[model samples]
Target: MLHETSRRRLLTGGLATLAGLPFGGVGRASTLFDPVPPLIPIRALPDRIFRTTVCLRPFRAAGPRIESERVGRKLVVHNYGHGGSGWSLSWGSAEVAVRLAMQAGDRDIAVIGAGALGLTAALTAQRAGARVTIYTKDQFPNVRSAWATGTWSPDSRVAMANAVDAGFADRWEAMTRRSFATFQSYLGAPGDPVEWTDRYTVSDLPPEQARGFYRAQEVTGFLHMGDRIADISPRSQLLPPGSHPFPTPTVMRNSGMSFNIAMLARQLTADFLMAGGRIEPVTFFSPTELTRLKQKTIINCTGYGARALWADESIVPVRGQIAWLIPQAGVTYGLNYKSVSVLARRDGIVVQDMGPNDGFGFNDTNETVDIGAAFASVALLAELYERPVPAVSPRTDP
Candidate 1:
């Protein structure tokens, strides 16, 4: 419980303070002597918005369930409940899930769901010499994972601080590192499936004052283990006044990897199929239904669908919505201003309202797209670029 106003400030300031700190990827650093490139302002007009999508991030207080359980005669390895970090922690989480599934000593493995976690788990199983088959109701772009923010946010709302045990941090760090390393391999892949880009965090308040808002959020009980693996990604650096193009007095910049979901999904699905893996259109209503599958080992990666399919009441739904604008050339970076965030992906420009606090949409399972909210988020970005850019002054040695 943070008040609405405080929560809004927390969302804005917290992102500027710790946005890309935990990402592990390749990026060039900016120096004082280097010339600052002019940023291509985002065209955030309502006419540019082509689609709106809503997704419920499966959030579990304790963190993702990565243990195995007996489902009748079959062994089901649970790998769901990653909250907002599903795409961010996929590879690493899959490593743990696949490891557990392999313990069953089964040559064939069945992966449930076809989202980020499921695809990664399927690929991980294939790499482990297991003949994998994915059983999912929908795949790729049709699934909820495709609606994600598509940024490298490894620890974003992964768990609640008070709800996790002491050992959770170590496991999270391991997963983050593994996921980061896996992303590097796709850096130069076709379609630019994974690549690093700059993110500018703009704030109207002064830097120190804005960070105070972030300090307030720290006591709100959200698990922030990004510091544990801070070495993995580049740190957010304060932009020198007049050296950056923004209407705001405070501007912080960081670089991290992003996934172009449209391209990445195509690549992942193709990789899975090319590796002799099979993906069947199958849906299960209960754990007992899994016993009918031929594979004795299974990795359950149903994501938000697990809340009903598995009857796990612990899984809370964090409602998130995104408004996609037509992609613009030369607009490859990201921006966070107010409570709104914009990411220019290969497929489209993603605009999102991150809400006032971590609990902004907690326990809210409504997946209906909010047209007004989507337009409002884009309007904020429109207002940002409308402001006059301050004149740059010559720098002098102190």
Candidate 2:
């Protein structure tokens, strides 16, 4: 992983490794960021064609809801509408939801939906000695969580900075730190469901212009309010001129974590079942149906599905599409340029464009694949890496 240095004091823990620094000196990072390392160009060849998938992210203006409310003798703990940070904050949010459910003094818990949040919350409640049963409409390859970008972006479009509650920042920090530590345990596995890689934010503009790439909501939009908890993810360091591999005048480099969602789902499912948790393939169209469940305490983690299930008008859909290119065994890193992002996962290389200011895919629930947008994303990568003419290749993973 790319190690970097920038001194700033804050709460200390096992976060030194996240910054690519030594554990003993948690406050200081290595001088790695100061020196330019050997750069490798990502081989975005044209023949690297694979399948594509798109889904809408659940966004809420007031951040994710983790409070418990009564629903006809059933205590419901809401844990949906995480926006684009669903995968990033799944475990942390699950921890909060499960803790609330535990307060109900109920040994039995029913978790709705089987996506990232649902699975994590189910596993967490089961670990707490609760008889957990997950009710979901879909699972595995069919679940929307599998369509995620699988990056460690805890605050991506989570909520408007001014719209959140006063204690939201502190709660978010606690969740981020807990989630980061939990993800670390999944590393070093053979399937590599969770791992770290160097990611670069490259831009054609000058450093000053590229840094100020947004308007009023630019900083929060670009970083997803991550600045409030920047220490959780690897700190980004500006790359010196001409030192980076990409054809960009400026680059921001950092070490970040990603999940191979399919593998992660498999692992979590197995763990849950092993821990005596149950899963039922059931669907609910309305919140009133939650009362039918045998369990007295329920946790809602339906993601975008919550909009219709709970009539939550506040939950907005931010549509996002990804073009999965054939796996390039040689390319191990990821990069973002001109709003187009490219990441190499175990299944395939994912490429998506969030627009110039990281705001293009907001409030767009269109499920249809825009051929123009898909091709434009591919074209951006082609401009940076050289390759031969395109060739047809079958799907690498089912």
Candidate 3:
């Protein structure tokens, strides 16, 4: 695990470790803004085989007792590991975790990591009338959640799935619905320039063959093999065009809309501040560190941070890199085929086609610029979308 930052800050309870700074340069990120902007097209490798991989279980940690931790002599809630669905399940998981956090019955609460999960956990706590504080390394825009292709698909990620009780899935389903409702709140402001692009996912056979794909296809896509995806949804609209210019046989809304992750992270930060949530912006180590916390209860929302401070092996990084194309800004919809391609709002036609071998490895060392590879992929999508999308990867997870 990349020790976010070797520098540790002294806190009242335990010490906090600052997240490792971005790879741009030492301490200062010189190439911070290299990926965003008046994005223009780039040349990628020709017929290059690109392997875009994400951890099949990105958030599942082999623990040093993270699921069971001590905090100020109170019960701590374990609410991480939604993988790509962290944002999608933010509210639901937080609701359950916060319920546990609240059961501790403390007036003050502590939240770990400030990514979408952390922010939502903090907000949920605050709403419950508990004063919440976030201890984090790299604030919002820097956390992994901010880099997510912000949609609503819980596919290709872990969420206590194959986890404990059957109730967990029901709980997740309810939360998913709740999250969709909550996402509506962050609509226009923070830059939801991207929205749910409802298009048909055509398969040669019938819908049953491709049933599960659209179900978990895009974590952000509010799919409704039975609903609608529109600009303005009466109830998170799900629109299905009878037949487009394509040959797509299977179809559903990828989700309601798309989001500029960086911007949404910023928006979430603002929401947290507005809700009166306190942020110490510090790091922590050792369970003994709780003795110094101003709050009695703590919520550990750290995503990958679990590996270091808690020494959790489950939170390993499924190294992923995006070949960002110049934003076809005019293009607001998104398309995803497993981990192959995603044309998002901020990051244009970005693809991280990691396969089983080198693609899925946790070596964040695959930042190759396969501009032509990306170009060819995008062109294919253009052709696909102009008509009907072909049968997608039949795999359950992306």
- The C-alpha stretches of model 3 lying farther than 4 A from their native spots are 1-57, 61-68, 71-75, 159-163, 188-190, 200-255, 336-339, 346-349, 354-398
lDDT by residue (89-206, candidate 1, tens digit) is 9999999999999985887999999999999999999999999999999987899999988888777778888899899999999999999999899998989999998777778988
Better of 1 and 3 by TM-score: 1
Candidate 2 scores a C-alpha RMSD against the true structure in Å of 8.9
* TM-score, ranked from best to worst: 1, 2, 3
lDDT of 2 by residue, 182-231 (tens): 99999998799999977776667765555445332243532244556655
What would you estimate as the lDDT of candidate 3? 0.50
Off by over 4 Å in 2: 1-47, 214-224, 387-398
Cand. 3 TM to true fold? 0.64
Per-model tally of clashing residue pairs: 1, 0, 56
The local distance difference test score of each candidate is 0.82, 0.74, 0.50
| Model 1: lDDT to the true structure | 0.82
